[model samples]
Target chain A: MQLDVSHISIQYQDNVVVDDVSFQLAPASLAAIVGPNGAGKSSLLKGILGIHPLKKGNVYFNGQTLSSVRPHIAYVPQRESVDWDFPATVLDVVLMGRYPHLNWWKRYRSIDFNIARKSLEQVNLIDLADRQIAQLSGGQQQRVFLARALAQEASIYFMDEPFAGVDAATEKNIVSVLKELQAGGKSIMVVHHDLQTIRSYFSSILLLNKKVIAFGPTDEVFTPERIQQTYQRESLLL
Target chain B: MVESLWADANARTVIVCTLLLNSAAALIGCFTYLQKKSLTGDAVSHSILPGIAIAFLFSGVKDLWVILPGAFLTGGLSLLSIEYILRHSKLKQDTAIALVLSVFFAVGVVLLSYIQHHGNGNQSGLDSFLLGKAAALLSADIPLYFSVAFVVVFSVLLFYRPFMLISFDRSFALSIGIAAHRWQQVMVVLSVLAIVIGIQAVGVVLMSAMLITPAVAARYWSHRLPVVLLLAVLFNMIASVMGIIISYKYPSMPTGPWIVVCISSIAVLSFFIGNAKGILRRSSLTVQK
Candidate 1:
C-alpha cells in the first residue's frame, strides 16, 4: 500500500522541530531517511507512524489514515535506545511483535512460533533464540529486533537508526533480509546516519533537518553537495 | 509482664493479620517494582498520615471508611502533582519525589503533634497508624486487604499488554496507538488504593517498604511479569509473617518496622543471589562462560 503525507508540521512547545513536509511512497518502496544528530529524523519517523501529535497534516497508509491501519505496520526501534539488559529471552522479545495480532487471552500458536523461528533464521539467530537479550553482542541485538519485525509480517516497516553501531557481518545480514522482504513486496522506511551507504543500500532518501530538505531516488538526491550540507561540512570550492 | 500476661487472642489475631497484610503489600509491590518506582511507596505512605488527620478533622469520625478514602485522595493528588512537576516544570523526578515526600510527611508530623499535645479525644489508634500495631488488626481488615489485592491482580491480568508495552517501551506503545495516559492513570490510581488499604497493617510509616521490598526480592527469581508478581507476593507474605511473629515474641515492637527490616534483608539477599542480574549470579555466569 502507498503512503501519502500532506503538509505536516511538528513543533515541541515553541521550537519548530519539523517544518511543513510532504511526500508519497509507492507500494513496496525502500526509503531511507538520513541526517545529522538533532535534525529531527526520529521525530519525522514518529510523526509518520502517528506517534507524536502532528502540528498540522495527515498521513495516510494505503489510502487510509495511518491510525486506521492497525496491526498492518511494524516498528523496529534503535538498539541503543532500548534496555536490552531487561531480563527476557530473545524468543520472548520476538514474541512481543505478535501481540497486536493476538486477541485477548490468545497465545502464540505453533504457526506463530514457526514464523518467529523463520524470522530468527532469516537473521541467522535461530540458534540463539532462547539466549537472554543481555547476553547478546551489539549486532546480534539489532538482528534480534529485525527478527521480531519479521515475525510481525507487516506491509510497511519503519526502523529508527537500525545500523548505528554494528559489525560488518550483522549489517550484511540485515541488508540481505531486507532485500528478501522487498522481493516479497513490502515497503521499508529506515532512519539512517551513514552517507556512504545510501547508494548501495536504499532506493529513496528523506534528507531531514527539521524539514524535508530533499526527497527522491538515492542516486539523484544523495549528491556530495547534499551530504556535505546535511553533515554541515566546511565547504572547500572557491 | 502485665501486658504479656494479658496478650492472648489479640496476639494471635495480630499474627494472622500481619501475614495477610504483608501478602497484599507485596502483591502491589510487583507493579511498582516493574516500573522501577519502588521508592514511591515510601513517599506516599509517609505522606498519607496528614491526609488521614485532615480527613478526620473534616468528617469528625476518624473511621477507616472515611479516612482511608481521604488518604488515597491525598496520595493520588500528590502523584498528579509529582507528574505535573515532572512534565512542565524543570524538576527531575527524583527531586520532585523528594519534594512531595518531605513536604507532605512534615505536614503529617505537625498534624500528629497537634493531636498528641492537645489530647484530641484518645488518639491511641492514630499512633498505630504511624508505626503500625499488627496486633491491632481486626477481622474486619482481612476482607479489605483481600479486595484490594483481587482488584490489583485482576487489573494486571486484563491490561497486561498495555501496561507491559508502556513499561517496556513507551515510544513503541505510543506509536501503536496505546494512549499510555489512560492505563498509567489506572496504575497510579490502583497504587493509591493499595496504599490506602495498606496503611492499617503496614502503617503509614512503613507502608511504602512493603510495596517495594517484595518486588526487589522477586527480581532475583524471574523477569517475566507474571512470574515477577508471583515471586514478590511470596516474599512479602514471608516477611510479613516473620515480622508479626517476632513482634509478638518481643512486646514494645512496631510490626511495620520489623516487616520493613525483614523485607529489606530479603532484598539484600536477593541482590547477591539473583540469577540473571545479581552480582553473584552474573559472576557465576561469567565463570561458567
Candidate 2:
C-alpha cells in the first residue's frame, strides 16, 4: 500500500521537464497533484509509470519495484490521448482492464467478464455496455475510462485529468468513486485541475512545479501562500 | 463464361494468387488503418524497388525467390529509417514517410533504368513491377505466395489481441506490461511481408490500394474490430474475383489495376451507402431530425 517516488527526473532533448522530483503516499490516501500548465505534472506521472523515459529516478510500492508490482497498479490516461472512434464497445474497453492478469494465449474467463460488467455498473454505464464508444459524449467517454480503471481492481490508481472537460454529473460521479476507493483502502493520485475543489476532493495535496513544492495533508499543505509559490502568481481567488 | 474461365489453368492461377494476396493484404491492412499508418504500406511498396533492381543485378535473373528477399531488406530498411527520423528529429510522421518514400523510390528508379540500359534481355520484365503482371505469374510462384500469405494470416491470428490493444491504446498496453514496442515491431514486420508479397501481383504503384481500400470500406460497415476485419477480407476477396473475371474477359486489361479498381469502387460505394457511418445513413438521420 506504500508508494514512494525518489529522485525522479525527466528530460526532453536536454531540457529537464521533471527535475529531481520525490514524494511518498500514505496508505489509503487520495492525493491531488496540482500545478500550472507546463508544470510537468503529466510528465512526472508518466515518468514514474514508465510511459515516458526517466532521466534518473526509482519508483517503489510496498518495497517492491514498479515492474514487480505492475499488476496491482492501474493508470487512466488523459481522454484526449486515445481516438474515441476506435471500434470497440464500452464493455470491450472495460475488459481491457483484465489484460494484465491474463497470459498470452489465455482467453478472458467468465470472472473477467463479470468484473467488467460490475465495473460498468459501478459507473452506471451498464446499459451502455454494448454501445459503440464513438457514440458517447465527452463526460460519458471519461466515465468509460474510469470504469476501465475500476475493472483493473488495482490497489493503487493513477489518473490524469479525469475531470477535464467533463460535465457536472460526471465530476460528481468521479469524486464519489474516488471517495469510495479511499474507503476501500486503495491509494489514488490524480493530476488535477480546478483549484477550487482540491481541499474537498483530496486527502493529501502535492503542489508541483517540475519538482515537489510541498507534500502533506490537505489542511497543512493547501495554504494560500504555498499555492502562490507553487503557481508563481500573485492572485487572490482562494 | 464462368465455367470456361475457371477451367483454364492460367486463369485459375491468377484467381488463386489474387485471392491469397488481397486477403492477406486486407487482413493486416485493418490494423494499419486503425493505427493511422496506412501509408506505411505505400512507402514500403515504393521503397523496395531498389532492392528488386539490386537483386536482379546481383543474381542476373528475375527469379521470385531472389528478388523477394531483396525487396524485404529494402522494405524493412525504409520502415526503420522512418522510425529513426521520427525519433531523432522533430519532423512530423507524414514528412518522414514522404522523405523516405521519395528518396528510396528515386534510387530504385535509377537502378531500374540502369538495368534496363546495361542488363541483358532478362531485364525486360522488371518494369512490369511498376504496375504488376499477374498474367506473367508461373505456377512455381504459387507456393511462395501461399507460404507468405499463410505466415501473414497466422501471425495476425496469433497476436490478434495484442495487436488490437496496441492499436487502440498503446500507452495503456505498455502500462499493463504488454511490450508495446515489440508488438509494434511485429506489426512492422507484418506490413513488410504483406507489401513485399503483394508488389508482384499489384505492383509498387497500386499495392497500397490493395492494403488499405478494403479496410476503409469495411470500417463504414461495422463498429467492431473482428467484424471489420472479416468484412475487409470478404470485400477484398470479392473484389479479387471480380478483377480476375474482368481481366479474363478483356485479355487487354491488367489484373492488378482491375483489382485496385474493383476494391476502390467498393470503398467509394461504402462511403455513400454503408450501414454504419455512410453518407446515406447520416443524411437520412439528419433529415429525420
Candidate 3:
C-alpha cells in the first residue's frame, strides 16, 4: 500500500503545531518520525490518521482518502494515554481490534478469536491472554498494544511513542516485530524520540521540527547537520 | 421474621420495587464508576429535586410520567452547567460538581418548602422525596419500576461493547468510528433515568449513593467490566432486599437510608475483605513477600 500525507497542518487555539507537513511511504518500509520536544510529531501522526482534527490537509491511502479505506489503517496510541487500571484482559483488548469488522449486534466468531490468539502469539503474549491489563509490565503493555494493531490486519500502522518507557528487551522485541511486519509487506510509521537508535532501526527517517525538515532514506537524510537543524541545537547532537 | 415480612402484601410490593430500582441503578452505575463520573451521579440526582418540585407546581400532581421528564430536564441542565463551568472557568471538576450540587439542592429545598406551604394538599408527599418513603409505594407502582428496570438493563446490553470501549478509551473508540458522543449522551440519559426511577423508594438525597456504592463494592472483586457489572447488580439486589426487610421490621425507619446504609456497609467490607485487591489481601501479600 502507498501512504501519502499531503500538506497537513494541525493547529490548536491559533497556534500552529504542525505546519504544511507532507510525506509518502511505500509498502514494506519502516519510517521513524524523529523530532525534538514540542515538535508536533505525535499530532502530525494523529492528524494523518484523522484522530486529531487537521487544520488543513489530506491523507491518502492507496491513492484514496483515508476514510474510504479505514479498515486498512491501524493505530497504536501512546501507552500513557490509556488507563492502566481499566477492567479488561489482554485478549479483550486485542479482540477489540475486530470491532470494526463485526456487525453492530454480532458477537465474535471462532475465527476472530483465532486471529486474536495468533496476534498474541506473534507478540509472544499468548500465555498472558487472560491476565488483567494492569498486571502487565510496561514493555508487556506495549507488546499487548502491538498485538492489538497486528490483529487489526491493517496494511498501514501508525504507532505513537511505542518505546517511550519500555525496557531493552521489549524494544528489541518491538523492532523484530516491525521487521516481521515489513517482511509481510506492511508500512509502519513510528513516532520515535530516541536519536541513538534511529539509523539502525529504521529504513527511512522523517526529521521534523513543527514542519517537514527532512524526509528520505536514513543514510541520505539522517545527517548531523539535519539533526542540528531539526532540534535547533548543536550541543545535543554532539 | 423473614417469612412474616415476605408474607405481607405491602412489604412484598416495596421489596419488589426496591429490587428493580437498585438493579437498574447498579447497571448504569458500573459505567459511571468506570468513567470516574460517580460525582456526576450525585449532582444529577440532587438537581432532579427542583425539577420534580417544579413539575408538581405545574401539574398540581406528583405523577410519575410528568415528574420524570421534569427531572431529566433539570438533571440535563445541571450536567450542561457543570461542563460549561469546567470549560469556561478555572474551577476543577470536583469544585464544579460541588458548586452545582449545593446550588441545585438549595433551589430544590426552597421549592419543596414553597409547595408545602402554598400548594394544595396534593403536595403532601413532596417532602417524602427528600428521604424516600418506601412504605408509601403502592402496588400499582410495581409495573412502572419494572419497565424502568427493563429499559435500563436492555439499553446497557444493547450498547455493551460501545459503552465499554468508550468508557475505557474514548479517543480510541472515536478513532474506530464508534460514535462516542452519541453513546455519551445515551449514558447521561440512562443515568438520569436510573436516578428518577429510584426517587420514590430511594429519594433524591440518597439516590446517588445507590448509583455508586454497588459498583464500588463490585470493583474490589473483579477486574473485568462484565464481571464488575454482574457483581454490581447482584450486590445492589442484596442491599435492596436487606434494606426492605430492615425498614419493614422497624416501622419508623425509611427505606432509602437503610438501603444506603446496607450498600455502604457492603462497600466498606469489600474494601477491607475483598479478594485480590482488598486491603487485607495487599497487606498479607506484602508480608509474604
Find the candidate with the highest TM-score and give its number: 2
Docking quality tier of candidate 3? acceptable
Candidate 1 residue runs with Cα over 4 Å from true position: A232-238, B1-20, B120-122, B286-289
Evaluate model 1: give its lDDT. 0.78
List ranges where model 3 is wrong by over 4 Å: A233-238, B138-141, B283-289
Better candidate number, 1 or 2, judged by TM-score: 2
Query: For model 1, how does the per-residue alpha-carbon lDDT over A46-159 read when each residue is reduced to its tens digit?
Result: 888877789999899989987688688888887887676565788887887777778746767888888888888989888888887777888999998898888888999999
Give the Cα error of residue A166 in candidate 3, in Å: 0.8
Interface root-mean-square deviation, candidate 2: 3.8
Q: Which ten-residue region of model 3 chain B has the weakest summed lDDT?
A: B280-289
Best candidate, DockQ-wise? 2
TM-score of each: 0.92, 0.96, 0.95
Q: Tens digit of lDDT per residue, candidate 2, span B1-289?
A: 8788889988887778878888889989999999999888899999999999999999998778998999999999998999999999999999999999999999999999999999788987788788777766657778998899889988888899999999999888888888899999898888888888887777887888888899999999988999999999999999888877877688667678988888999999999999887888866432100
Runs in model 2 with CA error above 4 Å?
A233-238, B283-289
Candidate 2 structure, TM-score to reference: 0.96
For candidate 3, lDDT tens digit of each residue in B159-269? 899989889877677667777889999998999999998988889999999989998999888888888899899998988887777877787787889889989999999
Worst 10 residues of 2 chain A by lDDT: A229-238
TM-score of chain B of each: 0.87, 0.94, 0.94
The backbone clash count of each candidate, in order, is: 1, 0, 0
